[model samples]
Target: MDTAPARDSAPPRTTAADARRGAPASRRPVLPYLLIAPTVLALAVVLGYPLAGLLLLSFQDMTRRELFSGAAPPWAGADNYRTVLTDGFFWEVLARTLLFTLVCVGVTMALAVPVALLMRRVDPWLRAVMAGVLVAVWAMPVMVAASVFRWLSDADDGVLNWLLGLLPGVDLDKHNWFYDPWQGFAVIAGVVVWGALPFAVLTLEAALTQVPRELAEAAVLDGANARQLFRHVTLPVIRPALVLVTALLAIGCTGVFNEIWLLRGGRPESDYYLLGVYSFIESFAVNRYSTGAAISVITVLLLLGGAVVYVRRLRALGEIE
Candidate 1:
């Protein structure tokens, strides 16, 4: 009886290509690729090309003579790295760079967190005012910030010194901040922290405002104190933002040249020569493009390594959510 009548065959299944053809034009993959093409091209030209050239140069003794004369020399192998590593100044610069980055990141977060919390409670008008100030600070060109900080930190005819004189119990000297390495580090760190605060505040403020009211109410109902609620709930929710802020700060710190160069321009003998400064000196002062490239490559590698490690740690902690 079952074989008496043949069942009608089901409609043919759709292949991916057939399905794509039937899909809406806006949902096509080609449109997305076209939209992203310009950005990808720009990134390759600006970032990728330079990085490739720099890596190639790092492997050879690429002097100005050889470059102009078109006479390639033998490869130096890892000599450039060896020279950079064995130098005492390199170690000092590395230490200063790390210390500056760490301290500035900590100070920036410390300043940002309270401001973000306060922003959550403020009236709309005050919030707008705060946002305006932060935007203004963020919009200040990096070079302008460096110049303003330099003028303010000047030993003579400087506003900071003038302000110090106003204090009743303090007697101060016209200390040459740019001359002393420690003082220069402090000044640079302070400027970086100040410049970075706006971004950190904005980011953290947005994150803090997004903390669910239901969660806060539940915490309160569970007899959680203000400190406990903030420590357990608020901090965990904002951990992603904190990591992002630290990564940005670290990247910026590694490439700090303008401030140190402008402030300590004539002092290579001083202990404030950072890797960026070193790279600049090699390229311009010594006309050693290869050496400069090597330094840049090393800096980039270090930064990328740090980022990779941070991402791995984030994955390990499952904090991305």
Candidate 2:
């Protein structure tokens, strides 16, 4: 009776390989790589080619004349690099660049994150108004904001000086904010930080909203103080957004030229120059194409180093894990 009740033979046991073989063509692991191949190729053509050319150009003794001439660029080994690296001016400019990038990133993030947090606690209408302002500020074009800030700090009839003049014994009339290098850097810092703050605020605000309110309540119920609650609960949840914005701002600020150029006025001294400005002035203004290329290469390397540090920081915080 038991033999008669035996079930039909089961299907063959499928191994991983067999299962993969049975999957749709599009579902195969290699399909995504295939689909992205064209995009990768296009990007290589666009970015990789130019970067390779820049690297090659950096090692050669190239100039505007040599580039335009019907001859190959001269091979100079590390002459261009030596010239850039050994120059006292380049180092000074680099220091200023680091200072500028750090200040802008630090000040912007410090103010923006707090403002974003406060927005969640405020009345909805006030929060709406605040968000609108941030959006409007963020939407303003870079050049427009730069130009506006330039006008605001104008030596003659600027609104900032106008307001200062109204206060008793505090007439900042016709104050040339960009006359000194430190002061010029300060003004540029102000403009850059202000322009960047709104985006940071919005990013943090979105991240803050995604954090579960229950975690905060749970922390409070466990007798966590205000500082402890934020440090333990809120900070970890939004750490990813914080790291992302910080890295992005650091990278963007490292390449800053437009704001400095517009705000500092044209052809500022080495004291006020950042790496990008230095590269531009060396390449175009002074016709040192090879030197500029070397500077560009150095800047790229520095940025890569920064990116590595940022990644390591995130990993250390377990954000990446």
Candidate 3:
């Protein structure tokens, strides 16, 4: 018959979404991975290789000889680690580093939180001024700040000593702040906190801006005092930022070296050794590259552990998805 043959039924076409749904569960969107591929590759080339090399170097008995001669260092296995771990001095330095970190982080948070809260309550112009000042401080070079601090706490003719000398019965002129490790660390901690404050304060302030006015007013309507309002409402809103800043501060403090190094004229005494300083001294000063690499590896492990804990905390708080 001349009638057209019945056309065969064609398969339904699928859209991208449909294809995604029909795909195996293990298959994810490749676009995201593709977009990130360049970044991952760059990091692998820059940071990953160095980190891997450092790890490998830690297991070798590298020294000045191998470094200058470009010779392969002897395989040391765990000998370098054992030597560092067995040293009482290393333990002392670790303890000092931890203690210094605690103090710096604690003081920074204490000062920053209050300043941030103050900013929230102040006039907009005042807040702007404060923010400008903080930005300026943050923008200042670390080297310049450290130099200024060193000059201030100089053993002779220091502005700090001069100011203290102004106080009746206080004779701090020509005082050697570095003579006492405790006092020296106090100055170092001060420098750290000063440098850290701007970031913490600005971060907290930004977080504060996100606090719902409705919630704050609601709390006030519920007869909540300022402290209670903060405890129940404000703190919850800012808690994520607070935790982040505190974690960063802790990590930064643990790795402090520049301030001490500059203040002590590049030859910091045993009393002034933090983990970073200790690593540098072992590697460069003592010419024990393997030992330094081991120390650095340990420090990295500790930092990684802290970061894991921080991530878990964020997840627990529902701050991270």
Candidate 4:
């Protein structure tokens, strides 16, 4: 007892765990903030600064000449915003973007659900093969895909025209796909949906695995067919994942440019201009930086609204707090 007391009196040595548990109240909270400060500072510099500058620029009159020259840009309070917002061209582009997003999301979800469910019930080898294909497509670079799409859709001696020529009563050799707005937009929608499906299918498959098979089995035993079982059982379980994917896809499709640009075949006067392309043209091609910034701000607001709606729906369904 004397020896023990003497040892105890020597002062308690701090272990790693002890240090963590016994960290001073003042230091503990500050330590976490200290650790995160670097990341926060980096993000502020990289993302926040640019976004703040864009917002400020949107409120100013930044013309092409001032953009090129070293002269200070003139201030035009809400003028750029008003000009961009009131422009008929901007609204048309925005409408096209929204329509494209709707088509892409609708088709992607429709195909992804079946594909995901199929992956669960398929043979091991088949499932592996399918998953590999999806992962490969999902991992494909956007630039590479765009390049391939450009090659396939080329006006002169393109594969699409060659294939069309093979069909009876048709001769589409060297046809320009971007000439017709509807046809061009439809083709774009197809490509976007194809590229987008892999991600949705893979995500849904992962989410489906978390769902209890017992519920599905119980539903099947109660005289429920495949459609009913999926409707009543699997739908609820995967609804959250579905909603998340929808929101992500909506945001992504709204800002899609690479594939659309490639499909548009570099035609500056093409009627197939979506919001993304319009913004690019204004900012870079026309050097209307403030107008482009205003468009970007509107796009951000649209995404925020989509996110808000997603959260509200999910909350209404009691999927999240």
| TM-scores of all candidate predictions against the true structure | 0.83, 0.86, 0.89, 0.83
lDDT of 1 by residue, 65-93 (tens): 88789997569888887877787877787
lDDT of 2 at 233: 92
Positional deviation of residue 275's Cα in model 3 after best superposition, in angstroms? 0.6
lDDT of 2: 0.87
- Considering TM-score, which of the candidate structures 3 and 4 is the better prediction for this target? 3
Pairs clashing in candidate 4?
Answer: none
Task: Output the number of the lDDT-best candidate.
Answer: 3
- Runs of candidate 1 with Cα error greater than 4 angstroms are 1-41, 70-73, 265-269, 317-321
Q: How many clashing residue pairs, candidate 4?
A: 0
In candidate 1, what residue range of length 10 has the lowest lDDT sum? 261-270
- lDDT, candidate 4, at 84: 85
Candidate 3 lDDT by residue in tens digits, 171-202: 99679999999999988888888899999999
Against the reference, the lDDT scores of all candidates come to: 0.82, 0.87, 0.92, 0.84
Model 2, 307: alpha-carbon shift in Å?
1.4
lDDT of 1: 0.82
For residue 298, model 1's alpha carbon misses the true position, in angstroms, by 1.3
Candidate 4 positional error at 316, Å: 2.6
| Between candidates 1 and 4, the TM-score winner | 1
- What TM-score does prediction 4 earn? 0.83
Decreasing TM-score order of the candidates:
3, 2, 1, 4
In model 3, which regions exceed 4 Å deviation?
A: 1-28
